[model samples]
Target chain A: MLSAYNITKNYQTNGRVVPVLKEVSVNISEGEFVSIVGRSGSGKTTLLNVLSTLVRPDSGELKYRDDNLALFPEKRLNRLRQSDFAVIFQFHHLLPYLSVLENTLLPFMSSLRPVSKQRVQQARAGLERVGLADKADRLPGNLSGGEQQRVAIARALVKSSRVLFADEPTGSLDKETGKQIMGLLMELHQEGLTVVMVTHEPGYASLAERTIAIEDGTIVH
Target chain B: MNLFTIPLRNIRRRPSKTLLLLLVFSLGVMSIVALYQVSLVVGYSLEKKLTTFGANIVISPATEKLSVSYGGFHLGDMVFDVQELPEGKTSQAIRSIKLQDRIAAVAPKLVSMTKIGDTSIALVGVHWPEERGIKSYWAAANGRFPEKPDEILVGSQAASKLGMQVGDVVSIYGKNFSVSGILFKTGSDDDSVILVELGVLQTLLNRPDATSFIEVAALCAGCPIEDIVDQISMKLPNTEVKALQNVINQRMASVHFVQKLALSVSLVILVTAAAMIGLSMLSAVNERKKDIGILRSLGYGKSQVFMIFCLEAGFIGALAGFIGYVGGFGASFKALEYLALSEGAVPVFAVAHLLLASAVFALITIVAAVYPAWKGASVDPTTALVAL
Candidate 1:
């Protein structure tokens, strides 16, 4: 479980201080599928980045299992990300030079812990779960947009991270492919995977067990 | 997959950039290797040629008498048990010198007083073959060299003073000698002497196998002339062996100057190569910003990212070094041939030197990549993903 208290993040743009997150607060319980909905400039992605420990809040107290994540050093944060967290980007962000299987195995390769045969098998199983088992040896460049996004999903879940943070996971896919991706997420959530997703689509946002709305960098409800 | 695959895959993905970096690095290494090898070969040949210029060491019997005279005046002084060099000792003493391979030539001379038509002149007996080796630049102005034991050669001054010509028979100590050649004017002690074979002059002077002094020409460019002199002195304890410091110093200075110049040039080339690799790596970092961010998000630490870039550069450097060494060695041989400087076979290739070159290049490359790799590792994952 993770919790935030009065998180405030600021961005400096050409000598001007712009507030992206203003004294925002939220709590994510274990095994809960939560979706954050907001307009284009509503600080939804900024909130996700802060919660994921990818960006530090200007002023906030973020806790994971009662441990102060905000006070942890970058090295500690990296370890936490490696062993306990996974992030899915809207653009997939897969390394173009690597094949699909290689992309899925990247987390294990980068982890401080030595990769085991069981971990490799788990990554293959993750790829199969995302319906990309047949495309494991193909490069990301050779895949369709939906297939690339599935590879990204497989990559995120390969290490069996406790929490998944997805930022518009199906933003670039066609409606039908987007529905398929959402269906996959729904099935994973039913299997007790904790997912925190940010999206602008009302229908996808409504699919989560809980939905939080934000307006002007503050939680509205 | 292992962590090493990422860098290897990245290198394979960008062929043109990697090849460009490899070419620049190899050219720098090639220039260094070729210049060093060429300088070594040419320096050796030049030193060998310089040995023939003149004698740098001299050996003579130690004199026991001292002159008690004013300037140009030989006031009478007592000679206490005058000692002369033993016969047949000059060659033996010279042979005993350490580093004898470095001794280019040894010319032994026996000087005796003789008369030619009522005029007293210095008759110098020399080992002709060794004298020719020492004075490689000597030439005859007229006629030809003396090939027979009864034939003799006269300096220009001696020929003019004695009114001698080729085929003229001259009497020396009741012996008839035909003038076979006249040497060119050298403007030295040689110009005033009548030259004859050492054996013939020793027999005529009634001092068989006697040598008054010896002149040794040694290649002391990389060796110590004092050591050779000391060895000669040790061999002939009653002889004074002296080194001509000025000649040896001049030769050594020239050889050292060439070597230093080549080394400095090679260093500059190496620095420029490092800078080229650094700039290229910087460009690569900029191009792969998103990839770095993704790797960080996936759990790669800063040091891991830095190491990946360094490994990529090191790989490029190793490949370049191998190619450069082989190419440079061949180039050096071609350079030597083109300069027409060396006459012998090329020097043997050293495996240790090749490995050292490769290691040096790899180290330089890794050092050059440090700043760029640090920059790559410092990329903020949040901002990088947002920008992408």
Candidate 2:
């Protein structure tokens, strides 16, 4: 389970302070699929970033299993990021130089030791689940937009992290490919994966078990 | 996949950038290596040539007493009655010393005054073969050196004063000698003396196997002239073996100057090379900002990112060092040939030197990349969200 109490975030632009998240709070239970919906500049993405530990909130107490993650040291935060959390960005930021399988195994590549054969097999299995088994050797640049996004998904699930944070995972995909990606997420959620996704699409928000709407940096019912 | 794989892949994917960096760094290393090697060889060559300009050590009978004088008041010359050294025994003793290998030449001389047509002139006897070794710059102004005991060489001053020619037969101490050569004007005492075979002069003077002193030209390249003199003195305890300190100092000074000049230039080149590497790494960091951000978001530690760039720089430096050393060695030979000093110079292939240069360049490049690598590590993980 994850909890946020009175979270507030601000961004500085052109020497002016702008409130992005204004003392908003939300909670999600384990194995639950939650979606945050808002218009552009409504602080939906900012809330997702703050919750995922990508960006620290200016004022908040973010707790996971009775531990305040906001107070964790950088090294400890990195450890949790590697083992307990996985993020899927909208752009599918795969390293252009690496192949699809290498991108899927990107999480383990940063380690000092060589990636184990068993871990490599797990990455391959992840790629297969994303329907990219035959395209493992192809670079990200050589793949279609949808296929690239699928590689991103494969990379995320390769670690088998406890929590999945999808930030507009289908923002750049075609409707049909978005449907397929959403269907994949639905399947994974049914298998008891905790999912916190941010999207502006009402249809996708409707597919989630719970939704939190934001307007002008404040949560509105 | 290991930590190094990312950098390796990036370098391979970016061939032009890598090659450009390689070329710049290789050129810098090549210049340094070439200068270093040339300085070593040139220093050796200069020392050898300078040592041969004249003898650096002189051995003479220690019993010779000095005349006493007070200012301009004349005092009679004092004599110890021992006029000369036993040439054969003394030469053998010098050759048997511990540092004899450093001895390039040993020319024995016996000086005596003799009348030539009522004008008394200084006559000097010398071992021609040994004298020629130390007097490598000596050339025939008119004819060749004396090859026979009956032949003699007349100095320019002696020839001008006596009006002698190369083929003229001159009588010295009532013995006939053919003038084999009119010697070049050396601007030394040699220009004012008549030189004859030591044996012939010894027989004529009725002092068999006698020499006034021995002039020794030692190869002073990396050799201690004082040590050679001391060793010779130990062998010939009754003789005074003195090293010409001024000549050794001047020779060493010239060698050191050349080496210092080369080292200074090498240092400048090293610094410029390091700066160039630092700038290139900075540019690489800028280009790989997205990669750094993504790696950070994937849970790569800041130090890990720093090490990736450092490893990339070290790889470039190591390759450049190797290429530069080989190129520089070949260039050194060419430089030596250009300076016309290739002959009589020994070529050395030091493996340890090569490895040290490579390791040093690698370390230098790694140090140069420190700032850029730190910048790469400081890239925020949130950049992954916005940079795309």
Candidate 3:
């Protein structure tokens, strides 16, 4: 569950102002499947960054469960990132030096909360769900682009995070792998996992329960 | 990030590099400490040799004194001040026989040097046992310096061991001498040494005008060292004071040159070791860039990253210091084993050196780590996120 009202983001580039988000806002309730779509330089990624709490919008009353994310301290934001949500970039962004299992297990380092047996069981189940149980011991370099994305998906589900924000989850994958990934995300959405995915493929974007189009910082609802 | 687990995990990932760092520094430390110990041992040994030479007013043409000199301008490192003669110089002081003009005082020593073949003994020569022995004298056991050349003396223990009488003509080193006064017992080489007159010993050793060495008592009132030697050489004229002074100065220069060379070489080695530490840490910082990013993204603070690299460098320094100190201590023990003064002695932890090295290591490690630690810590989370 998330809400933002009249959000605006600005950047000072070599003495010139560029607005990334201009008084645009949206909301998604629990178990909602929402897609944000845009062309290059259309502020799609910036919108996702703000929604996932990775970056705060310059002027926005961003409320998650009635709490302002901009006012949350860095430590609290880190905890929020650790357990409340997960993100999937087009690139897997897994640590190159760590094995896939270690990459999947990283969120626990920021969480002081005890990692019980159930957490390990959930991680294994996620790995099994993504068909990456055999590849758990490998590093990201050892996997293909498609397989790496699968590992990122597994990592997202390992923490049992309620909301998933994906910026082009299938952008770097082939058509068959992209379709398979979209099928998995839909299954998770049916299982009451909220997902907000950004994609270039209209076919995939149309599958979402709702879609918001953004162009040069304005939302065309 | 879990602080302990992360840094330690990185070490296992690159084993050879870690060992390379360890070995390079350990070698430096060992060489430095070992040579340092050698210098301390050599200094202590020289001091022991000086004490044992056992002569007061030890004059040896100034040039000969330079044969083994350590600290500043040397004259047997005057351990004790010379005993000034009593006031009102009279006939009692005017008793000497050779080079009478330059010689201010003359005393006699007749000592029995027992021959290896027979019970008979030959005599060695000496001077006023009182004057030389008065300042900080060697204890005499039995026989004393003879009152006359004809009167030979023996230590009391030697007298009993030789089974000879006062009037007997004892054969000593192929010369016969009458055993005169027996000495009171004192423990030292004095038991074996014999004392005699400058004249008799000159005759026995077949040198008519010279004593074994002239012990110049610089008692000439208001005279510095070179002045006294100059005045004595002027009296003799056979040995030029200028030539002798030149020789002594040359000898002193050579000793200083050798010590200077040793110091320069050690300093170069220390600098090289410090440089190696810097280079290794810098290279390691580059190699671990990806790992650093992972840690930073995982919520490791900038200070935490800085500390990890600093600890790595500091650990190397501490390890090297430990290696060097142990190496130095081992060397010192081996050298001490050769000494009769100390038997198989070993050094305990010198707290002063330990503390000094700790501070030095801390300084070097921090200096060495600063650039590398800063490089590791200044990683942009954006760029680092891309690395991940």
lDDT of 2 by residue, B11-89 (tens): 8888998898899899889999989889888888887778678888899898767788889987988777675799999
| Candidate 3 lDDT over residue span B168-190, tens digit each | 67655466677666666656544
List of chain A TM-scores, every candidate:
0.96, 0.98, 0.94
Which residue pairs clash in candidate 1?
A: none
Judged by lDDT against the true structure, how good is candidate 2? 0.87
DockQ, each predicted model: 0.44, 0.57, 0.11
Give the chain B TM-score for each candidate.
0.81, 0.76, 0.46
Best by lDDT: 2
In order of DockQ, best first, we have 2, 1, 3
State how far residue A195 of model 3 sits from its true place (Å).
2.0
Instruction: Give the TM-scores of the predictions, in the order they appear.
Output: 0.83, 0.81, 0.56
CA lDDT for candidate 3: 0.64
Q: Report lDDT (Cα) of residue B187, candidate 3.
A: 65
Q: In model 1 chain A, which range of ten residues has the least summed lDDT? A: A107-116
Interface Cα RMSD of candidate 3: 4.2
Candidate 1: C-alpha lDDT? 0.86
